[model samples]
Target chain A: MNNKVALVAWREYVVRVRRRTFIVATLLTPIGIGLLALMAGYFSTKGAVSSKDILFVDESTIFRSADPTSETHVFRFSDKNISEERDNYLENHDVLVHIPPFENLGDKKHQVQYFSEEKLSVMTINKLERAIAKAFKNHKIKSSDIDMEMYNSFDTKVVFEDGEVLEKIAAGEEDASKSGKLNLIIGTILGATMGFLMYMVIFIYGGMVMRSVMEEKINRIVEVMISSVKPFQLMLGKILGVGAVGITQLAIWLILIPVILWIVQSTVGLNDASQAEQMAEIAQNMNGQTSLEGFDIGQIISEFQSLNWGLIIPLFVLFFFGGYFIYSSMFAAIGSAIGDDMGEGQQLMIPIVIPVVIAFVMLQGVLSNPNGSMAIFGSLFPLFSPIIMPARLAFDPPMWQIALSVVILILSCIFFVWFSGKIYRVGILLYGKKVSFKELGKWLFYKA
Target chain B: MSVLQISDVVKQYGDHRAVDGMSFNVPKGSIFGLLGPNGAGKTSLIRIITRITGADSGDILLDGTPIQKTRVRDIGYMPEERGLYKKMKVGEQLMYLAQLKELSASEAKKVINHWMDKFDISDWWNKKIEELSKGMQQKIQFIATVMHEPSLIILDEPFTGLDPINTNLIKEEIFRMNDEGTSIIFSTHRMEQVEEICKDIVLINQGKKMLEGKVSEVKQKFKENIYELIYLEGELKNDSTYTIVQNDGQKASLKIKDGLRANTVLQSLIQQGIQIRKFEEQLPSLNDIFISLIENKTV
Candidate 1:
């Protein structure tokens, strides 16, 4: 490094690192977020599935008695007088279901009622509904006097073009939808966290660079600084210095997140052991009950693990820095041109801030359909691509799109750096008057 | 020997010409004054000398070599728009600037300590610039500018914001530095200070050199052959030989025409029976010369 640039960079890095606000914000915020993630993970995995007891009373003499028990519920049948049934019957059972007798075998009128001490879970209610539907179908068959064997032959399964392909695709879509819910929620959280950080890091540090330039310009230290070092070096040094601070903060958070998560996971793991015992007892008592078909929590977890992190992570770092460099250079130029007036600096920031703001807004649209036109445009647009592209990585977009977005982003970054450098050289010395955009346009044509 | 030279430097900003074919030289070990009114391109010329901004069409020679980017390290430039980072501590800010001038860390620290003690601001080393008064910050800036001990030092209105005591202190230091063989370029509109310190001066107006010579010679060139006389008895009469510019009962000033001697006027005044208490030839002050030159440009 040139000694002058190193010196300027070092000063910027040290001064910001020493600030209490930087230290507190960098360290405490991640720990807080980690704790929140910990709580969410713990609750989701700890005893969320439910089991219940159901009592069945059959008063009808026209039909044979049937037994229906599921893994998530136990059914106990009884023949009791209707007058003996009390309102407080739930003290012993979770649910009491009654089927009233019909006056004639051919009568279609029948009444049923269910009483539960607590509101039944959706899964438990769905299981009961399916069991009732099968019983009714059996009763209807008996009344029709159909031959059981002949009727059984008519219960044929219609096969599609290929069962394997249908099953595989259905399973794939199912896993996708399941894991999609899993990954997207997790992805959105992670993406939003990282995106918010990227937004703040770029905006805050870019503002810092701007303010630093303005400070030097206002104080007229820039003139003395320029005499010893080129304006480009000064701007680069500040960008690098402030950038290093941001990277340092991010690195600390990166390390803290996993460490805190591990602690939380271990704590939750201990609770899962006791929960397993209770679940096993419920499974034993409710024998023959169907388990939730196809939507295995384990499979969803493995899908989360299978994400292409190798590609996503490296790309994230690249875009984070590339985006930061692009915005901060323009901010530095604006700072230089603003001279001593702070109000004009803010007014000028609109141009610099608009692209990033639009990127974040487009991020919302991308979340709904990662393959949508808006998503593709946001991912490809150099200004929005840094934030949008990384978010789309969870959706596994085509490799060519990622590569193209990256190429455009890198090229745009280089162009902006050179462009801002031109303005920075002349703007630092300007004073008294606010610089308009027209003047900056003229500066672009000046000879190096 | 000239330590620095500028030949035909021109800088144009849009349709306006900021520096138009200006030229000057700074003799080695002399205190040179760069004088101009506001908006007369004094800053543009200084910026070019410091290499802060490049000249549109010209060359500047420093120590007989053409000025390059690296040559700025040997020249200390303190501009009129002086400032320091208000949040930075005095010691650290100075260290950063001194190191930018290519001084080693230990050497910079040693020199910084020496200057802080010299300026009596050693106690402010750890204090943020905002904690110090404005004059104190100026002192720190001055220290930072000179800490590397450059061969050529340029100060633009260095004493503007300072109180009288601090101003005198800086003036003494400027003189002391010049005496030790460092060429100094002092730019200011305050001609009195320029008269006291600078030996050679270049007065610029509207981006062009209006006057360039030694202070003594420039004043001599502008002399109008005016003389002031004070007597206790009578007033000298105005005539073709000498015109009484101003007169009172006992005091008068007269202008001699056609290369007439002051002795002739004195002898004539005595013949008029005026008891001569004080009789001396008067020279125009730098203030008068600067005003006349710039006003001449406007006219």
Candidate 2:
């Protein structure tokens, strides 16, 4: 590196890092994430939703068996007559449901009166209705003159003409268990988070490079700067400097996040447990599952383990550097061409940002079907690849595809740096008139 | 000996020539004034010399060697569009600029301290450029330019926005640097300043050299052979040897006729019994010569 370029980069890094805005924004972010994690942990440990206590006043003396129910509510049977015991039940229970004696046992629509000191939550009411309906179904089944064992056995078999019966135990969803579905959700969430982080870094840091260029132009330091260093050197120094600041901030977050989370966990008496375990517990309770059945802790763990970080991490670094350099160079060129007018720079940013925005919009599609044609195109296209390719890595995109994306992104970054350098050489000295896209095209062909 | 030389330099912007066939020599240890009106291409020529821009067809030599990138360190350039980062501290900005000129860190820091102390701006080391007044900023900029101890310094309108006291301070520094064998190119329209400081000058008009010579020689060359006379007594007649351009009783302004000397007019006036109180040759000022030459397109 040229000494002057190093000097310029150092100046840029030191000046920006010392700013109150930069320090505040960088330091506050990890703290904020830590706080958010703490809140999430506290809420999860308290249980996904607070369980509501329900008193059942069954006048018909039905539902003597233990209830199979959702986790969000506790049900109890009251022996005393509700009419005579209404005051006692009301004194202790906030919600009381009174089931009246049935006149016609065949009537499926039985009436029940719900009384409460305060209005029960809609979720609580829904859970109570489901429990009541289940109880009624069980009562109707028991009153029938059918062999319950035989009926269930018949329901479990699918009879064929050859007397070849298929047991329901080996049903269509034997492999497609609830846990399998949970794994898919976990994979998509992980992919989206990575994609989101890449998008933010590229977008935010890219804009920062452009603003820095505009600041130099407006302050009229560009001429003095270029006098000492070549225009390309100046732009490169700025990009690298701002990029270093970004990397520093990211590195801090990477280190600080786990430390902060550990502190938060210790504070909440949840130390010594892994994040995945807490997440599984939180996920299970969120669905109101009384037992961990149908909530796959193992499936989620395997899914997370299956993520190809070895391939993904290196690719992520490559893509981030490539994407940031390309976008930031263009931003710097636009800033130079527009001189001191920030408004013009903003309008010109739309065309440059369109592809990145498109990639973001297609992020969901890419995450779901990593090998789909759309995903392939997004991953390979230089403009979108930096964001889409890493996201698809968790799904193990073909090696050739990753290699192709990396090569294309690298070549494009080089092309953009060369192209923007030309415009920058001429633009930094151009002070007044607004430059149009047409003029910018002409600037590309300008002699060095 | 000439420390810098430009020959047949041509710069064109479309069909209009910004610097056309411009040539001049700046000798070592001399204060060379580059004088011109607005848009007279003085800035363009300076930019070319400073290597901020290139001339289409010309060669520039420093110390008999063709100018190259490394030679940029030997030249100090303070452009007319003077600026510094408003948010950067004065000392920091100066150090950065000095380093940009290829000074090592230790050398840059030491020179920065020395210049800051000499300029009496050591208090402003931590103060931002924005916090300083325009004159103070100019002083800081001047310090930054010379801190590298370049062999040649090109300053374009460096005195603009400076109060008289600060201007004098800078002027003294310029002379001192020249005395230390630094060739200084002082570019400005301030003729009085050039008269006060410049030993030699090149006057350019319309992208071409209109005049170039020692200041005394150029002044003497433009003298109109006119004499201002104040006689205490007697009457003087306007003869073929001399013509009185203006006569105000006791004082007369006479233009000596072609091939005649002022001494002849004085001798004739004494023979006519007129006592001469004062008799001195009058020459046009640099400003007047500049205007007439540029306006008339005469060499």
Candidate 3:
């Protein structure tokens, strides 16, 4: 933070922040995400509310007393023959379901024909099949004289139980199981979002730093600046400056996205009755049920509130900066080594790009098993920790592992910055030379 | 007193020595020429003086103290491959560079205004560097170099893209700055400007000093004892005292023999009844000396 370095940093930050492209990108991102959410909400709501009315030609005689209505379909038993209904059902009903008569009730190969003018949606088809199968089971159960109460009791579900939740339940905590389920969902969502976000910022802002360095070199302004200040100072100033830009954009997005989403939800979620119904249906689906009794927006909000924001938020900031610094310094080195030919730098970029790509590719696996061996190793390894460790943060991994990862990441950031400064010192003054990895290695050892 | 001094500097790049055991001095308030062919280590030595790159083994002193980071304020270097941020405004770019030299914001603004006014480029204050013509850009760059008013200024090939008028304008400014007691190191291969403005020079080749002295003294050291004569009568011919290097009907050039006086040659010409209209000794131009020295054809 010397005076000259600070001056250079201020220049770098101001120049980029004032660019038209930066302004457009910063403003458009939240709008784009808002639009995407609107589209998804619109489509899901439309699909869920488009109810189908069915004419059931029950030739098998088993579904004659079946339930008349389900979540998305209304069924009516018809007395007409199959040919009569098939030709006239389109005038009133949306579909004609003709169940074939069979002597054996348990035969798996019995065919049922469905006739519709338009292609039926996958959800509609699956629901119809399930309704017909349920009718057959009921008929067969009545004929065999099975006890209805005992049969109802046989529908058992397997619930996932973690050791901590089991201990809480033993300690007389009745809502422990409910909170555990919510934690699983929230952890997966938070980890994936955070991991992906870290991956993206490293590439986006790191590339910004690289291109800015290359621009200075190409413009040949670096030599004049170098004469006034050390190369290390210049490089550090640029990284910090562009890093500030990244943080600024992130802060804006954090505020703008929620506001925009709230506006969209109020407009699209409140005015449309069908969208409210669709959200209730999705909540029921998440609870693995077909009834809307479990749909509670307040409970979902409480679940979100239950997260350990005090730990997660600060760790996220630390990892975000650590990852950005580590990758950007190397990017600055590659940019300096590129010379006048822009294409020549691609080969040197492979080493830096590989780790980030690997971290992103491994994100899914880490989310599935946050405390597994792969997740543990990936989270502690300095190169991958910025991405993987933040992803595991929501899972509440062991405190010792988190501490170790943070320490390693901070140290690596310092090392890489110093290392890249060495390469940048020699490379900025070099022109028209195709620099290679070997050349960069030699420059790393060069005297300042 | 010398404003800057270098002693036995050696800078090696792998197997090749870019600056090999070089030494020189820039006297206070003098315009000095650093003359060398391309790749002759003139830039290497300049970078060392500017402290852009450290010399592998050497001692560089500014005002009798070893050069350090703080000394950057005392030296303004406009490198040969120099440029300004094209997208940056002329005034802001000047302010940024001024601040790097530790100028306060208020001081920088006042100095920038004075320079822009002095150069009559006040209208270009808000214009980006890329918007200016090449000569105009060069003028702005020259102003940036001197706006800090450093005790020493190093300009490498400062006049490459300037038009004749701008070049003269810059030349006048250089003379003015020197008269105000700034030590200037002018580096270029253009020998004519060196002959016109430089009081002393160091000519180097292959990273080694080949010749160093006052401009007139070096030209005298390379003189060939040749004389040009114009006359109205009599003919000239080779004799025991002098040889006719070239001859026309009215003018002749002669080279005196070793250890022979110009008076003796003149007497011989008089005895031949040559009525001399003009007679003057010829000294070599710097360009000729530079070529002969680089080509190693003459001492």
Query: What TM-score would chain B receive for each of the candidates shown?
Result: 0.96, 0.94, 0.95
lDDT for B34 in candidate 2 is 95
What TM value does model 1 have? 0.79
Give me the displacement of residue B181 in model 2, in angstroms: 1.0
- The DockQ score of candidate 2 comes to 0.49
lDDT of each: 0.80, 0.80, 0.86
- lDDT of each residue in A207-279, candidate 3, tens digit only: 9999988988988888888888889999999998999999889999999999998999987773355556666
Angstrom error of the Cα, residue A137, model 2: value is 6.6
Candidate 3 has a TM-score of 0.90
Q: Which stretches of candidate 1 lie over 4 Å from their true place?
A: A31-197, A257-305, A364-377, A394-399
Of candidates 3 and 2, the better by lDDT: 3
Q: Report the candidate with higher DockQ, 2 versus 3.
A: 3
- For model 1, the DockQ equals 0.54
Query: Which residue pairs in candidate 3 have backbone atoms (N, alpha carbon, C) closer than 3 angstroms, thus clashing?
Result: none
* Per-prediction TM-score to the true structure, in the order listed: 0.79, 0.85, 0.90
- Model 1, position B42, has a per-residue lDDT of 91
Report the lDDT tens digits of candidate 2 across residue range B1-299: 89888899998865669889988898888999999999899877876777666678888998787775445578888888878999989988888888888888899899999988888878889999999998898998888788888988989888999998999999999988998899999999989888989999999988999899999999999999989999898877887778898988789989998898888988888888988899999887899899999889899
Model 2 CA lDDT for position B214: 91
**Residue A309 alpha-carbon offset, candidate 3, angstroms:** 1.6
Q: Can you give the DockQ of every candidate in the order shown? A: 0.54, 0.49, 0.74
